[model samples]
Target: MNENRHSVIVIVIIIVGVILLSKLFMIQVVDDSFLRRAERNAVQRIIDYPYRGLISDRNSELLVYNNPVFDLMVIPQEFSIKDTAKFCDIFQIEKQKLIERYTAAKKYSWVKPSPLIKQISTTDFAKIQDYLIDYPGLFVMTRSVRAYPDSIAASALGYIAEIIPRQMERDSLHYYNQGDYIGHSGLESYYEKILRGKKGAKYKMVNVRGVDKGSFKNGTLDTASVAGLNLQSTIDMQLQQYGEKLMKGKRGSVVAIEPKTGEILSIISAPVYDPNLLAGAAYSKNYNILLSDTTKPLFIRPIQAKYPPGSIFKVVQSLIGLQWGTLTPNTTYACNKALVACHNHPSPVNLFGAIRNSCNPYYYQAFRQMINQEISSNTYTDTQIGLDKWHEAVEKFGLGHELGVDLPYENSGSVPSSSLYDRIYGKGRWKYSTIYSLSIGQGEMEVTPLQMANLAAIFANKGYYYTPHLIKAINGDPGKIPEEYTTKHDVGVAAHHFDMVQNAMAEALYGTAMRAIIKDITIAGKTGTAQNPHGEDHSVFIAFAPKEDPKIAIAVYVENAGWGGRAAASTASLMIEKYLRGHIERPALEEYVLVGDFGD
Candidate 1:
């Protein structure tokens, strides 16, 4: 019995030894999980950030370029400082600031690299070369910062800043890191994917001191980061600069579009600061200043500001009437008490004359006829059908909706639908008289400067329009734009109907908008004094130059500017002259535009 017991014990010991050896072999050879974890500390990943895309005007004039910059990175697990004072002096940063940064980086991650200082100056960076090796896990990473050459078009170009936690949560692709930068608004945000190139990384073998030993696996595992694709913007730099100058000291917006392509020529929202104000090391400081300013310079008015389009929308009324067969170029409506008081003009003007004269009663009567017109024998009263037709026709002109411009944060200016009226005035309680003010572009309608400019493009095209977009081409690929941008959006109105209106607008440049006329250039334009319930009226104008073969379509809105005939028209005229003639011949007109305080 003793011998048998000893034999069982010996067999048990042999079985235990075999199990331990097999487990060890599997962990060391078959399962590489432990090996990878061990290599994690030795083989450090160096992120090779690609150069951000370049931006240029349609004419190939460089608007934004990349300048070499440096960010000081630190790994919390490996970070150690021997002399805090020396570090501060070398980087020219406050000691407290360094401590704060170090604490933040440590809190964020222990193993990953975090930026301790961003956008260090060249002189300071050069001085730190000898001292940098002293601090382990502290090194400079080469990157590029955006540099605005012209310092104009701040709102259009937008600004880039560090990505926040919210962005990380929203980014399902998991591309960005904590300290990475991203486009916050404007064209930057619109083309972020196309403009932001793919990020690549290099695996490098490093010593315990964080000193680079050599490339891991001889760089076979490394990836080369490609530079971001360049953007060729539709904006004309000369026109943009001139528009900004014209808009100085005024609270307003100016937008110009190419009639044929719907490409934006120049878009300005004032009072604008230099784009440089939002770039480089002082970005955070200047950003706070801009945020605190009362003027709201950050607002992109061209596609965001919603206001009553005023008499500029009268052209749309005429087109709708023409579509309904309720009005014609010769259609006359007598000026009567049906419409409210208005600025003096010839009474009972024709369709063309009503626009040229801006007669309020004519528009009111015109809108009445349009809404009263029978649709399959449906009466105007106790019915939203006719009014709904009017709404559909108007929306087709790109009003009451975003025109899909290639920029972010566009406001879809409201166009009260028939259902909206059903809610507001009760299903059938509304009538033409109930919304008479709408005929003159007042009541429930609102339009962005971009939408208004698109209206001009529609008229310039005599019915159809391409979606207004800031990017003319991407990566120099002209045909690579969105399908909708290249597609023509026909308003479903006949082209011939626009001729009379164009002729009338041409006549107006010699009449109410006399100041809008350029030397030997017959521009077609309409002036609007959009009523403001709060304060003074807003000056608004929509126009296209050289009436015959239209090139540029523009819209201008000057807040609290009494008459569109002055402020809006003058600005439009100067912009047209500058773009077409390459210079301004009307010095007196330029003086009026620059020194005018119509808004005040």
Candidate 2:
């Protein structure tokens, strides 16, 4: 009996030992959960972020550059604070804020590191970095914040901010992280993919104290980051700054472009805030301040605001009339009937004289003839046919459409269509007399300042135009001009027709645009006073320099400033002289513009 009992006990003990051994094997060798936990504690993975690309002007002038900044990261699972008071004081944070940030980080991920504080300036980081040792899980990581050296081009250069949750989810490539900086708007947003370079990873061994000891696996597992490609913008910073100065006290926009290449020289919208205002630590604060102001300093008017092309559009009308064969350079129109109000210029003028004097009656009769072309015997069919044909011609000049410039938020100004007129006056019911104001560029046509500048470039190139763009070169290569910008868009008007209109425009430098003349350079320009219901007429001007081999084309607009010659033409003339002559020799004129307040 005793022997049988001892055998039973030994059998039971053997079964228990087998069960224990199998359980140990499963946890130690088969399952990877414990292995992953071990690796997480032993290794620290650091991301090596590449520097964002540098932004410079076509003149090699730095516009947007990066300044060193720091982000505070926390691995919540390992966080230990020996002295809470010292830690809070060093970080310039309240005790409650520290608790909140730490709790949020832990909720995000206990084992992985997350950004606890962002965009600390280098000076502030230097002030507190030595105290970092007191907190075990806290770490300082290097980053860059955008800086503006010259402090111009606030709206053009744009600003960068941290990637939000929405951005991360929408990141189809999974390229950005929670704290990654991204270009939000302007040139920055347009070139984001090219500007943001590849990020790399580095692995380091860590102790219980959470100090990085050395590279894990002798750095074999680490990857190197690549810096972003640099960009050279078409902006001539000097010209841009000068244009900004010219518009210091006014409400307007100025756009200058290189006609041959479609490179933007300068784009200035009045009431601009310093680009630095939206950079670094003060970004949100300054942005809010700028946004709340009634004048809307944050609004980028060149691309944002659309106004009637005013008298400057008569140049387009002249071309349209010439192209349709209803009018010629010598075609005479009797103007003494006073159909539209006159601007005190000689009546019964030729085409060149009509353009020079900005004769209201000439365009009225000329547009009437184009609209009344005999497409069919019926007046309605002919008028609709003629209107549609005229609309197509105007759209060819890039009006009633977005110019597709590099910037964002550009709007296509409305082109009055037959459908629109039908909705208003019913089909076959309206005639040219019903919309005669359209003949003079006043009724329903509107355009952005960018499109107006492109018009100047179109005339500069005669019948063809390169689509306007902001980037001149990328990664030091001028070959980067997009294919869309390089292809010539012919307006289908005869080349010689531009020559005749240009001659008439030159005559305007003596007549309507007398203030635009520079004795050293022969500048061709036109002036327009757009009627404004809110207040005084908005002054408008368009011009190109040196008549022959024209280099720069420009458009200028000043709101509520009566007479296009006074503020708009003067400003354009000064800018043209400055760009061509390298200095404004007419100091008195410059002073007059700088000191004058046309706002009244």
Candidate 3:
């Protein structure tokens, strides 16, 4: 019995030895992962960051470029310094801040590298390089920060910021790191994927002192990073600069488009700061100030702020009426102030005369004809049917919906439909009399400055418009644009109906908008004074130059600037003269706009 038990024990020992030997062979010879893990102390992986794309205007003038910056990285396991005070002094960082950063880094990863300090300028980095040797785990990584040369178009150019924890987790491809920068707004955010190039990797050998010896395998395993593709924007920098200049000290926005191609030549939001303020190391400090300011300089008013279209919308009313066969060019209505108040003008005028004089009663009576078409025996049902039809026609003009501009977060301004009225006033309860405020572009009707600019382009084309976009090309190739920008949208209005309206707008300059007339340029335009219950009226103007074959279409909205004939019209005229003539011949008009002094 004793001999048999000893034999069983011997067999069990032999089986266990065989299993251990097989496992050792599998780990040592079959897989190199364990060996690679062992080499982590001596080897370091480095990220090769690609240069961000450049941005230039239609004139080939540089708008945005990059400047080299440095980030200080730390591996928590190897991070140890005998003199913490001296390190803080070199970096100008507080002792408590340093401790917090180090603790955060340690929590992130003991083995992996994390950012200790970010966006140190080249000059600042140079001052502290010699002292870096005293810290074992700390290393320098080179990257670039955005630089705006001309310092114009702050709202359009946008800004970039570091990737946050949530953003890193959402990175499906695992591209961004903790300290990496990404575009935050405007064109930057809209074209982020196209503007951010692919990243590469480098493996290097490091001594115990953290000194770089050489490439890990003579760069055989290293990959090359590709620079991002450059963007050729549609903006004319000179025109954009001039527009911003004219908007100085004013609270509003300006948008200009090429009537033929739908390319945006200039887009300006006033109360703009130097774009450079948001770049480099000063981003957080300056951003907080801009955010807290009561004036709200950060607001991108062109696509975001919605307001009543006011008298400028009368042009659309006439077109819709003409298309639906509710009114005609020869339709006449008396300038009866009882329907709505109007300035002194000829009474009982035709369409052309009414448009030139901006006769409010004519539009009121014309709108009545449209909404009270006698489609149903019940007055309420007939009003509903007529309003639904009108709403459908208005939607074709790109009102009440996003125009799909190549920018992030564009607001879809409201256009009241029959259903919206139903929600407010209950079904079958409201009619033309309750909603007549829409006739003169008031009440629930709203539009963005960008949409208004597009309206001007539609009128310039006589019945159609292309989608407005800022990007003209990618990597110098204009043919790579999206199909949407190239598509022509017809407003469903007959082309002939525009002739009378165009003729009237040209004559309008000689009447209410006389200040908008430019020398040698026959401009077709309409002025608007949008009423504000909380403050003064907003000045608004829309125009296209050389009424015969329009080249540029524009919209200007100045808040609390009184009559459109003053601030808005004058500014639009100066912009037209500058863009068309290449110089401003009327310095007196330019000075008047700059002064911005309209008596209360």
Worst 10 residues of 3 by lDDT: 204-213
Query: Predicted candidate 3: what Cα RMSD to the true structure?
Result: 2.1
Best of the candidates, lDDT: 3
Residue 472's C-alpha lDDT in candidate 1? Answer: 77
lDDT, candidate 2, 199-292, per-residue tens: 9999998776566689988999999888787889989888888888888888888999999888899998887778888888777888899889
Per-residue lDDT over 17-53 for candidate 3, one digit per residue giving the tens place of the 0 to 100 score: 9999989999999988898886787787888999889
- Candidate 1 lDDT over 232-257, as tens digits, reads 99999999999999999988999999
- The per-residue C-alpha lDDT of model 2 at residue 437 equals 87
Error of 2 at 421 (Å): 1.7
Which is the leading candidate under TM-score? 3
Candidate 2 local distance difference test against the native: 0.86
TM-score per candidate:
0.95, 0.92, 0.95
For candidate 1, report its TM-score: 0.95
Ranking by TM-score: 3, 1, 2
Note each model's CA RMSD in angstroms.
2.2, 3.1, 2.1
